[model samples]
Target: MTGGSPGRQDIGPVRQSVDGSTLSTSLEAAAARLRRRFGGRLLEEAVFRGELTYVVAPSDWLRVLAYCRSAPALSFDRLDCLMGDHLPERAERPFEVVAHLTSHTHGHRLRVKTALAEGESLPTVTGLWPSAGFDERETWEMYGIAFEGHPDLRRLLTTEDFEGYPLRKDFPLQGTVGGRIRIDLRGKI
Candidate 1:
């Protein structure tokens, strides 16, 4: 979080060095563009290790990504990856969905993130980037981060009767005790 809180829209554009090595500048420009376009919907922005990350409201997830994809200044037309992080100790929102995007036209990368409370549904971005369909399904099955509006939302790597989310930080290492078992031992004994 190099810059001050960028949640405010109305902030002035950041200036880069005249020499034109503008990784930070480009990141700021993306943040500014997002801020200007999304207004208060932009929750927080940060530049870390020359990479820009924006934390946005869950309600604005699809719209923000759509803007990044379609807007000329951004044109982040590629969805590199979609993943989830679970921090169950946080009382407010324990789940985070991180989307990595790249702009072949603009020649930069940015990470968009949104936080969701337990059981909160995430708006699907598969419509914007069809490649995210299976990734979202994997995240859903692994972390239980539900993706709303996903056309075929189902467990990608687990059985239909899987009990709990496996990737949450709080999930037990040995697995849940006394979970359901469908085995029958009629004549074997």
Candidate 2:
């Protein structure tokens, strides 16, 4: 299992007995199970380019995350990281949330990504994984994505009085007041 970066390889498909029939496969199978259990809400499946990622609708994110953690084959117990992405021009959902999950026992990793439109909110997964608290908060502070169930949802990396999300693709790189290049020239000549 691999996450985030390209070149990560998933373990080859393996056979496993679910019932009377022997239906065995790779991460694709796991993704199928999730989709079947969750219905047609899943957006993208088997999208294992840079990482073994499953993109779900923002509304189904909480359920999907829980299923990934409890699913027999894809037992992702560790929450490695959670990040946010900004895609301004995308007609669909603009903000993307990526969660990296790892199973130490199985030596496998899985990435779950969900897209939320502007002003939309995603359910928090901190109930399943305590480490998600800080990660989700940071994502909210940086990308303006809100985690509905986060206990202490607040700005993490930015000041409380910060005006806008600094990481959104639409957010200007330069300051609004002066339109000046906000470059750090402290050590550069």
Candidate 3:
């Protein structure tokens, strides 16, 4: 295993993090399995509300995902969801691609994230999870973030003639955006 990987063989004894809180055996096992594959490419790991999330490097995105799906030890075969986030605050890498993966064999789930710049695109994961077909298209349409290898990446929700990303933060709040239909319910529900 490479340096910065999380595992018993490489790092040894993952019973607790620096905070000294015990982690579930499954999480440790999953981390170890991932370490065996990707090593130190994992940037950060966080657990909130008992859910584990890993921040991955954009360059390693495709390989990490492939490992998650194919590795027997990790077997994260389920692509629960895939979405994109636009964080204008982070200028260097403002766009984020988040994948929710679940392993039925391990009975655990993991959230993986990778950040990219405005023009950068991620390799499509549709090859790993067929369910990601529409999700990637929808995300690309809404966020204006491209999926480089997506087979059919055309707008799924918006018309082919539509212009601009509607879900982007900077998208016009009021106006005829991409010929959108609007009903002005003047201050009343």
Candidate 4:
């Protein structure tokens, strides 16, 4: 990754050239380039609460992550975290998987989020970042999301006997109640 201003550890923004081409000014520029390349499929492109976040379609997730790693200005060599959120009640997309990417060399951070419909499986990134294994496992166990090509996909935090997904909105919070009991009144009377 290209070094930018002093104290700016990670990728920052990039500037435009006189020929109407874009140039890397900082890490933000790298993200902008990704947005330009993906176009309408790119959902969110702003830094949220101090983290660079990019939400894209599930089909384009792998390509987007690959681009982020390949782009010189934003070489996020590490997959910091990968997790999924359950939003079954939403009228639109009901599920989302969030991947956090970071570059120790550039000291930059980027978040990639992909939306998936019910029962959809997301492409595995473990091949690209081995650290994603545990994260993917946790997501799968909690959200019932399948990461295609994951080496050992299994329940991480839950027991093997557990039946339904605990994190999904549709999952019932409590098990069925058996029956009601009548209180004895002869002793009190």
Question: For candidate 2, lDDT tens digit of each residue in 1-189?
Answer: 112222223323322222323332455566556656754555544443323566676667888899888887778899999999888767667788899998775566678887778889888899889899999888988888888968999766654467788777777887652232344459321
Q: 68-150 in candidate 3: lDDT tens per residue?
A: 89988889989999999888877777888899998889888888998888888889999999889888999899998888878
By the TM-score metric, which is better: model 3 or model 4? 3
Q: Candidate 4 — which residues are off by over 4 angstroms? A: 1-25, 176-189
Taking the tens digit of each residue's C-alpha lDDT, what string does model 1 give over 1-189?
Answer: 122343565544533233433455566777678777887666665555566777787888888999998898898999999999887666678888999999887678999888889889888998899999998998998888888889888766665577787888877789454334444457221
Candidate achieving higher lDDT, 2 or 3: 3
Query: Model 1: clashing residue pairs?
Result: none
Candidate 1 lDDT = 0.77
Identify the leading candidate in terms of TM-score: 3
What is the TM-score of each predicted model, taking all chains together? 0.80, 0.73, 0.82, 0.74
Candidate 4 structure quality by residue, lDDT tens digits, 114-133: 77877889888888888888
Report how far residue 185 has shifted in candidate 2, in Å. 31
For the record, the alpha-carbon RMSD of candidate 2 to the native fold, in angstroms, is: 10.0
How many residue pairs clash per model?
Answer: 0, 0, 0, 15
Q: Alpha-carbon error at 103 in model 2, in Å?
A: 1.2
Q: How big is the positional error of residue 104 in model 3, measured in Å on the Cα after superposition?
A: 1.1
Regions more than 4 Å wrong, model 3: 1-23, 180-189
What is the Cα-based TM-score of model 3? 0.82
lDDT of each: 0.77, 0.70, 0.77, 0.71
lDDT of 2: 0.70
lDDT of model 3 at position 137: 90
